[model samples]
Structure formats: structure tokens, C-alpha cells
Target: MAKLQQTLDDVRSIELDNAFYVEDGTWIESLTVASNTEFDPETVLEEISGVSLFYSSKIPTASEELEIRRLTILANESYPFILSLILRQEAIPNRIVLQNDVFEIVATTRDWDQFRSMADEVQETLGEFELLSVTQNEEPGEPLDSGRLTEVLVSKLTSDQLEVLETAYNHGYFDVPRETSETDLADELDITQSTINERLRTAERTLLELIYGPRE
Candidate 1:
């Protein structure tokens, strides 16, 4: 087994948010202690204001891998909604920060009691690691990525097809209400549904190809 690395030192406290527990079907604390720690999302961004965070934890068992995959899909599905909250200024602090060691986390917050409760839950779930403290900080950066991912996503599409994807994503067509229709989109793009579908299929296939590499 891979040994746990040096204990996390710089973490000021474990952080949590209302979304933390809800986004995934299971409670965040329900996750194995072996895999997670308390993280304050805001203070973390302050510590590494410019860097993107990446983290991974061991899958001690098969069930845990399934859980992680579910959690990842849930997070991805919820990202645009989460981001809209920040963009509309409906939610406090826009991002959460975590260390690559998978031992520390920084989260955005507005309520102290809720945050405290989250910390308690995390410390309980992620045994051994301790929650030290929470502190406030200014300097929230732009909520959206600099379009690197979007650019990459769009690059796979023709200019006209890219426009459709952006329009769908922005209008939340991919979201729950299905605000936009194929007819509406076809009218706007001056294309038939069959053509639109083909372009989108090409775009999606290319995007996946880029992300996962060509098939074997």
C-alpha cells in the first residue's frame, strides 16, 4: 500500500459549504476518511492565488472507486450551476482551493456556523487530520476559467458549431429546464436538426478524442 505522505502543515482549517454535501448524492462526510480532509475554500485561494489545484486520493477498495467516479460526475454536472451562482453574485466566494497532496482544502463561505459544522463533519470523516482554524480573506479572482477549456472545447468545433455550443451552454439549454429547443437553435443557426446533430456529434467526438486520446 502507498503510505500516507507527510502530514498536511499549511492548512489553516478544514472547510465546507452548503453545496459540499448536497452536490453529490451522498453526504461529503459519508466519503471515507482515508480519502478526504476539511478544507476552507476561500483562504486556500489566498495562499495560492494564481495556481490551479489538482488532487487525488487512493482508492482503497472497489466501492471507493465507484464512489469517486460518481462524485466526479456530480461535480462536473453541477459546475455550471455553481458558477452561475457566483456570476450572478448569488453565492459567496466563487471557488474552493485544495492542495495536490489531497490533504488540504480551501472553500468559499458566508456563514460561520455552517462552515464550522462542515469542519466538524470533515474532521470526523477524515480521521487523523485535524481542523486548525478558519480565517477571512479578500481578493476573489474572476470566477470563470480564462477560457482555456472552453477554447479547447470550441476548437474541436467549426466556428458555426462552436457558436451553437456556446449559445446552448450560456442559455442553460443543457440544464434542467431545457430553455432552448432544436427548432429555436436551427432557426438561429439557419441549419436543419440533422445538420446540427451531425456538427454537434463531430464536436463532441473530437472533444472526447482530445481529452481521452484516440481509441485503441
Candidate 2:
């Protein structure tokens, strides 16, 4: 695990935005683009064969932040080369978390050979990668305290539930004034309003149980 973290850090150090382990043997990352660079989602999807783009939205306001776009990609068919290597090592990818220019991934793997293979493959693919320090069972350089709550909550939620929760939070669904509506969130996620409501309710129930313990 340490070796894998080091490899991921090294890959990200080379002008990439950010990289980290999510959970369940999945990895997600993003590249830093210049402010003037034109982004074409179709082109990106074409280039990375095994990855699926779930959601792409700009942060801090779309017009104000042209250089950064939050993207959620799921590893599906083994393209992107890295995904193939990880799959070959028998690792399972979970989900991807994108924040501004950084991308975080969750994955699970028990085999050292898999980690080493991934590191080697990344180094070979991208020149100028650097090896960094790795912490046990945690994303590289992240203190366990800061990530524990999220990890725990994430473990209890399905991927769709997590995505809906995150989207709601991002859109201020829980704000005092509620900047966005359930309908709007559904539209953004391309799901029905009832579906969004059910997911939110279930997610909230799970979260509350986590916070206060199960009710009698």
C-alpha cells in the first residue's frame, strides 16, 4: 500500500493536479489545465477508453473558473492503461472524488505485487514521476483524523447514495435558504426528482445513525 501511494504521488507530482486512494481499490486523478485550454468532454472520453465520465461541472461559478472542472470518472473497460494495470493486479476500483483541480480515488487491494506493478506501470507511462512517503491504510500525506469520518460514512453508503449526497451538498441543498431545489439537483444528476429524494432520505438516515447511533 505504501509503495502504491508513493507511486501515485510521484505520478501526480509531474504537473498533474492531484491523486489519492479513495477506498475499495479504486484510484482517481485529474490533470491541471491552463486557463485558456479548451476542454472537450467527448475528446477526453475518446482518449481514455476504459473510463466513464459521470458528471462534469465547474466550481466557484462556471464562468469564473474556466480552468478547473470537477469530473467524476468510473473505471469500466480497462482503458486509460493505468486502470488495465490495476485490474491485471486484481484490484477493485470503487469511486472517484474530484475537487477543483484535484482528483481522489478509492480502491481496495491486498496484493503487494499488484501495488508494485501499478507503480512500475505508472513510472513507465509517465516520465519524471517521483516516489513520496506513504502512510499505512491511508491516502499519502493525509492524517487519519481528517479522513476518518468521511471514510466511515462512505463505507455505509452506496455509490449512488454517496454521489447524491455530495451533489446535494455542493449545490447547497441543505443550506438555510436552500440555494438549489430537489428538482434542480435531479436535473443536474439526470435522475428523477423522486429518485433524488429517496436517495437523500436514505443517505440522511444512514448519516444520522452514524452520528447519533442507532435509535431504539
Candidate 3:
């Protein structure tokens, strides 16, 4: 997927189905979710990438939506070792902040994509933000502080393995369709392909260890 860093301004929100979300004139760089609202990844991705990549409830009951949010939190906690990208919103003046494990971005009123309901009133953008999409944008030329999720992944790695992983991500080794081949990385790192593969395996194992932790 393409990573967008551009800011969008003066956008209104449209509510549909059982939920409400924003649609920007341009591709969305970030979106915020209130702590109180349910986190709907499908709705978020639909707005951002303009495509729905997962399941969402059509005839959703209030309890069902709440249950979905609970499930998301549970999944994140169950495997906290996995990197997560989160967008938090405040409602006072309509602001959005994007957080990765690494850095936080505070966007202006123009930055937020909010939920709209006829019965509800929005006083600020910072409060009770909605949950937007979850993505992996750990490469260069994307967003500043873009590597929060990657940092989560790195947190699971040893210092040395983290170096290798960071190199792979920054050098576009992990870009979709793969901008750099294994042979290219092998040449750049002056190591054999077998060695690179071993490093990657070791890194993955260590991350899983951090996540599951001895399985006891």
C-alpha cells in the first residue's frame, strides 16, 4: 500500500450504516478515534485506502460494536509484541494525533477525520476520537515518526538483530513487490544470502519469544 503524509483540510464527515467516519478530498494521511467509539478497522481502511479489506457488521447491535472494540483490545494485549499503529482523536477543536511506538504527531483541526451523528455534538477534536485503520508504514518517505509499529517489532529483537531489521526496512527491502532482492541485501551487507536468512529467522524467533514468552 502507498503511504501518505500529506495533510487534508476543510473536510466534512458523512455517516453511514451504523457508524460515522470522514471522507477527505484527498487520500487520508491519518485519522483519529475516540476512546469511547468502537474501533472499526474495516471502516477506517475503507476511508483511507478507498477499499474495504476485512469484515464489518451491517445490522450491528450496540453490544456487537462494543464487543468488536473489546476484541481489538484483547487481540492487541494477547500479542503485544506485534507492532501497532494507532490514531487518537480529540473533539474540542477537532484534532487528530497519530502514534507509533516511536513518536506522536499532533495535527491541527484540518488533520482530523471525525465521526458525525445528528444527535451527538462535537466540541473538540481531541476527545473521544474514533479508531481508524491499522497499518504498517515503516519505510522511508512515508510519514515522520513512521516507525512506531516497526519499533514495536524491534522492541522484540536483540540490539544486533534490530539493526538488521531496521536496515531492511529503511532500505526498502520489505516494500511490497520487494524493491530490494535478497541478493541485493546480501551484497550490501557483505554477507552471504544464507547468513541474511539466518539473521532474519533469528530476529523473527526472538520477536515471537517476546510475544508468547515461553508458552508456559
Best by the lDDT measure: 2
Best by TM-score: 2
Q: What is the C-alpha RMSD of each candidate to the true structure, in Å?
A: 18.4, 13.5, 19.1
lDDT digits (tens) for residues 102-183 of candidate 2: 3344445565666666667656764433445432464333211222334456679887887788788778999999999999
Whole-model lDDT values for every prediction: 0.42, 0.53, 0.37
TM-score, predicted candidate 3 vs. hidden true structure: 0.34
Compose the digit string of candidate 1's lDDT tens values, residues 1-216.
Answer: 001112323332222222333443322211111223433333332353232223323222222111110011112222223223332333344333233444443445556776665555555544544555667767544432322343355446676666666555656668787988767767866889887677667767888898799899
User: Where does candidate 3 stray beyond 4 Å?
Assistant: 1-114, 117-156
User: Residue 56 of model 2: what lDDT?
Assistant: 57
Error of 3 at 151 (Å): 7.0
Cα deviation in Å at residue 28, candidate 3? 29
Residue 76's lDDT within candidate 2 is 39
Report how far off residue 206 is in candidate 1 (Å). 1.8
